[model samples]
Target chain A: MTEPLFDRVALIGIGLIGSSLALNIRANGLARHIAVTTRRRETLEKAEALGLGDSYHLEATEAVADADFVILCVPVGVCGAITSEIAPHLKKGAIVSDVGSVKGAVIDQMRPHLPEGVDFVPAHPLAGTEQSGPESGFLELFRNRWCILTPPEGTDPAAIEKVEAFWRGCGSNVETMTAEHHDLVLAIVSHVPHLIAYNIVGTAADLETVTQSEVVKFSASGFRDFTRIAASDPTMWRDVFLTNRDAVLEMLARFSEDLASLQRAIRWGDGDTLFDLFTRTRAIRRNVIEAGQDTAKPNFGREPGNGEAAPGESTGS
Target chain B: MTEPLFDRVALIGIGLIGSSLALNIRANGLARHIAVTTRRRETLEKAEALGLGDSYHLEATEAVADADFVILCVPVGVCGAITSEIAPHLKKGAIVSDVGSVKGAVIDQMRPHLPEGVDFVPAHPLAGTEQSGPESGFLELFRNRWCILTPPEGTDPAAIEKVEAFWRGCGSNVETMTAEHHDLVLAIVSHVPHLIAYNIVGTAADLETVTQSEVVKFSASGFRDFTRIAASDPTMWRDVFLTNRDAVLEMLARFSEDLASLQRAIRWGDGDTLFDLFTRTRAIRRNVIEAGQDTAKPNFGREPGNGEAAPGESTGS
Candidate 1:
């Protein structure tokens, strides 16, 4: 294994991203010690039981004490408070970072609280699953995924390099951009897509004529994909939308405008418009597959099983 | 081997669904002879090259001649014309069915063209991949997927039973519903979802600040799942939205209303509203996975690969 990059690395939360980071650090020997802290004692106990860190603490200050690398792994809404709690306890030369989805808001929240001499860099590893909690994380979660760093202007180059090296060690490609640009890009790519998914699933769930059970039964038709995205961590997504409001709203507006046009096309039977848009979108999937961001296997590589019980066999009426 | 369900099966299209049906029919001995036909000579040649049928014909009437079962596997928009083309050549008491996405429209279109004594049952197998064409099909595509039949009222019961049994033989569970209900259910589950995906991908592509390359590079963050759905057969989806206009528009209106409320939540910083919706949608995903419609694997079971090139290493400037 490579030489340890940090003597003591403290994680401020132990959810999916944190637990995965802890496992990655241990597996890659990226840190000599990992200290994990969470608000809930049960979560701390679960992290310890899972061997996510060498030391567990209920207090953020305790976790950050003597730590050279402190990564805030909580929801974006809580990152500021966590930073305020742990700021005074951090080592003088510690490199402070985060794994929040909304980088600009995260940076704004944490930058003022950080003590002098400590480097603050906001990072977002564009990887996760629908499952959450400490048990949901895996060692290879970051493999081949992007870890975007939105370092504030004039931040220490050495600190950014170390953080970049850390992500590379954990098998993530690194890209640096201004936090504003990052938020806009993520708004279109992540935030709005998720919002639309949550919205559609909610719509389907709320339908009177189409029962929820029927929706679930026929989900393989296309609705199931949206459900997976809509199933993402609620608190984290809430913070994402709240903190990245302007960008998400902007993207949603554009999405709504485009959707209205499409709706009209359907109404007027403008098959050409629908066909052109559909064909154009097909190329993006190909690009994503070629870029190594997604799989090329059919149906997202889902395994075949016996089809759901036949209608006559299961219908009770 | 099981008894042959029919003496001859005629497939009027040789795309993904048609070819997969052809393969499934041969593997299960569902038909003594599989006759394939397509409007394009190239598709017929490709199906022949893949050995997808025993007899290949360029003309729909030629393929349906003396056939016991004629499945119109083309887009919903073309079902009526194709049915009219093959109606005169169909054997007496021949079962005419289709694998179209929009059932109500398909039944409306084809029911009038089918001659007396010919059975017209509209079937939609809720299974497919983003890829299309004869080469993209496999024998197992229909395994574990639901096939819904929307036969018109007073249709021959024996013909309906045969169609249901045919789907079961192809490894699909069978359900029967009215054509109107089928269209509404599918409008929510398939058509609107596809329309939104296509719209969002178009929106992302048209962004000024967020370049197309950036969207492509960072698509793994939820946007890529949509691209897969958006990549589906454009001609098929266009026809679906066109024919299922009323249901799709209804669903879209509901979706837009829900999205407006969500947008307000985000704008007002109402985290609880966002959180509640996100949490509620999660249960649907669990149900879908348990129902055997989707996989539980993280990131849709994408395989691990080497991370993209390190940013610093790739930056020539």
Candidate 2:
């Protein structure tokens, strides 16, 4: 195999994303050594049992003592404190980055506390399941997915190139953009979608006319899709909304206005307006399918044997 | 083997649900003969090519002639016109039912036009995919799914029992309710969810800051889930919103109020409230999975080989 990309890489929090990164690094020989740490002892022990890293440390500073690359995998709200805790022990000229959903706030939180001469590149990988914890990860999670890197202005080009190459080696297509642009793009694509999902699920749950059991029983129609998105990691999403406040709020405002117009059309029996919007939205799904961001299989390719009849029942129908 | 439930069953508008019903009727020997009709000649031709029925016709009256069971599978808006056209040809004591998403409007539209001796039962099968057309169906589409029948009061008991048995034979768990309650329940579960999905996909497409290509490329994060629901048949959804106006409007108002509160929490950085709401929603997903309405597999069990890396890359990671 080719030489590893880094001598040692340190992960500050070995949750779903962190454990997946560790597995990918090992699978592709991207790093020679992996150091894992977490605030909770049980999580550290779980990572150790899973063989997620070559070394385990309870303290963030010890994990990054001799590491050539350090990635903070904690929630976005804790990046600043973690950066401050590990800044003293980071190897000279070591590159620092984070796997955060929100870019601008993460950079603002981590940039100042970094030691002089160390490089910082913030990234958000557009791939994940609605699962958390170390056991919920796999090496193939990042394959063919987008890893967006938001390098602040005046950063070292060599460090940015190295981070980009690292992500590519882990089987991700890399893109570079400003932190502000990244935040806005993610606000629409990720943040607001999640917010609406959470809102609808909550609304369904709190309805007096419809029982919760009925909602759960007949969810296969459409409400189940929202439930899946709403089941995402709570801590991570909480930090996402807290950090990316302005962009998410702006997108939510636009979404509310559009929804109000749709409501008006429905109340007034304006079939033309509803049909036009529904037709326009179908094109976006086609675009997403053509772009290979999702599969073309019905119901996201949910297998037939799970609850539906066996596949043999088709009989040429 | 056994005797069929009906000597002749006529299906008008052989689209996704209609074609699926035809297939189920054939697979389980629920009917001796199936007659299919559609307004479009191409769709009728496609149904004939697929052998979805024993006979195909472009006229509703021709399809339903002398049939014991006649089902209207067209959009809710067109149900009244088609019912008026087919009423004159209906056989004495024949059962007429419709598979429309909105129940009250369909009953209101079809009841007045049905012949005096015929039985009218309305149903909305809580099953479908993001696909439409005669060829996009299979025998197992209704397997283990809910099919709710909304029959008017004072209807013949024998007709309701026959319809219930027909649905049961098609592999659906059946329930009966008033048309008003069915509309309200479905508004929260199906109609409003579809409306929100269409709205968000539209909002993402119309953004000036983000290019459409970028949104499509990075959709796997959360936006892609909404796209699946948004890609549903446009005419059907338009009719659903128009016919179920009162229930849908009430649900939308509740959703908007809840969304505004969530937005306020995000603006003020209320992490506790966000965490509580997110936590509560997770339990609903669990309930859905437990109730067998959805699969518990991550990412809706989208297999890796569909577009990304091959399945062999997992290696138990």
Candidate 3:
């Protein structure tokens, strides 16, 4: 059998991404020993109960001591402080990484605190559910998803390749790009879409004309799809908008400007403009499906016997 | 077996909703005979090929003649002209209903041309996918879905109950409201959500810095969900905006206002504001799930073995 990838690997933060990573690392024997740490005793105990790691620590320094690789799986907002605390104890030649959603901000936060001889490779796994916490994770969360790595200039080629292989072992296809490019691409594809979803759900809830019950009861008509992403972890998303502000704002401006034109077309009864834009958008859905980023099944395959209420029984999505 | 609900039913459009209705009607024996009509010969032939109807015709007059029930299952924009063509041939005391999305405009379009003896009831079945045409339908499309019926005040009570029973037989929970209220409610629940989905997809496609391929690659983060509804039928959506202009504009303005505040909070780095909104929206998702409007499964159950590319394989959603 192949040897484990690392002798000792430290996973800081045992939330959804971290817990899922723990499951993958252990299930695939990606690391010889797993050291887990988190801020809360309850979360750490839960991780222990789940057997997510070989050893557990409350302090960042304790977890990082002599670890060959360290991955910060916490929200991006707190990476800098955690980096400072763990910098003194990081093993020489240790490969440091993260599962942050925003790359440029995360790199800027962690790169300054790193001690010499440690290689930092920042990555954003394009995989998640709206669900969070230790219990919400599973073994297959990262399987078949893209894990994008953005390493700083002059970083060791050997380190990047090892990290790439590590993610491959966890069941992800690895890609690399500049942090700037990753932020812009994610701003449109992930961050901006999430912002729109949160904004719209909030809007729907605040409306006095449409009761909250009404919105909830009638949500199968497209609104419920937005709620899936809108329901994501609040702390993680707050940090995302706080750190990736400029790129998100730029993409959001484009979104709002286009929405204005659609609203105008509606007001003026310009059927051609509405029809043209609507037709163009359909092609993008086809591309997303064809590229394997999504499925073609109706309603995302939420149908009868999939736990939905069948006809003459109950109302469901 | 009990007698069928009607001796004959005339359905005047062979699109997604029409074809699905035909399947349900025939499968459940809601009507003894189903007569289908559409403007396109190919669509009529496709419906026939699918065995969706007992008889098919290209002319509205031919389909409606001697029919005990007539349903205009066409787009709202052309409802008036088709209603005019079918009015002169309507059988006395026949119950006429339609499956249009917008109730007020469709009522205004069709009510004036109906002959004296026939009773008119209009309904909007709150169920569909991002697919269209005769073939893109299924028997369970209306199962566990809400179907709203908006009948003109003082219309025969017997007619309203029969249509409700027919939809109930087709596996839907039926509700009644005035035409104006139905338009407003649907504008928030269905029409506005669809517009937002279409607008965001259009905005992403038009970006110069972000390649379309990049958008497709990273779409699993959040944007792919929006693309599902954005791919819905163009002509149908165009008519929705055209006919339900006031309600959609009202909802759009409210949506834009809420988004502006969220954007301002992002620009100013108000983490509390962002966090508060994000937290509040999570509650809405729970309500939707508890109401049976959605499931709590991660990524809507699009996981490994659900046709997704699994770990150590290829990329997938």
Task: Give a tens-digit lDDT track for model 2, residues A1-317.
Answer: 99998999999999888999999999889899999999999999999999999999999999999999999998999999999989999899999999999999999999999989899988877778898899988877888888899999988999999999899887888999999999999999889999999999999999999999999878888888889889998999999999999999999999999998998898888999999999999999998887777777777767653353212111000
> Lowest summed lDDT over 10 consecutive residues: which window, candidate 3 chain A?
A308-317
lDDT of 1 by residue, B13-67 (tens): 9998899899999999999999999999888999999999999998888999999
lDDT of 2: 0.87
The worst-scoring run of ten residues by lDDT in candidate 3 chain B lies at B308-317
The runs of at least 3 residues in candidate 2 whose Cα sits more than 4 Å from the true structure, single-residue gaps closed, are: A305-317, B305-317
**TM-score of every candidate:** 0.96, 0.97, 0.97
- Over A105-185, each residue of candidate 1 has an lDDT whose tens digit, in order, gives 888889999899999888999888777899988887787778999999999999999999999999888999999999999
lDDT rank order: 2, 3, 1
Give the worst 10-residue stretch by lDDT in candidate 1 chain A. A308-317
Candidate 2 residue-wise lDDT, B135-204, digit = tens: 9887778887788999999999999999999998888889999999999989998888999999999999
lDDT (C-alpha, whole model) for all candidates: 0.85, 0.87, 0.87
TM-score of 1: 0.96
| DockQ of each model vs. true complex | 0.46, 0.52, 0.56
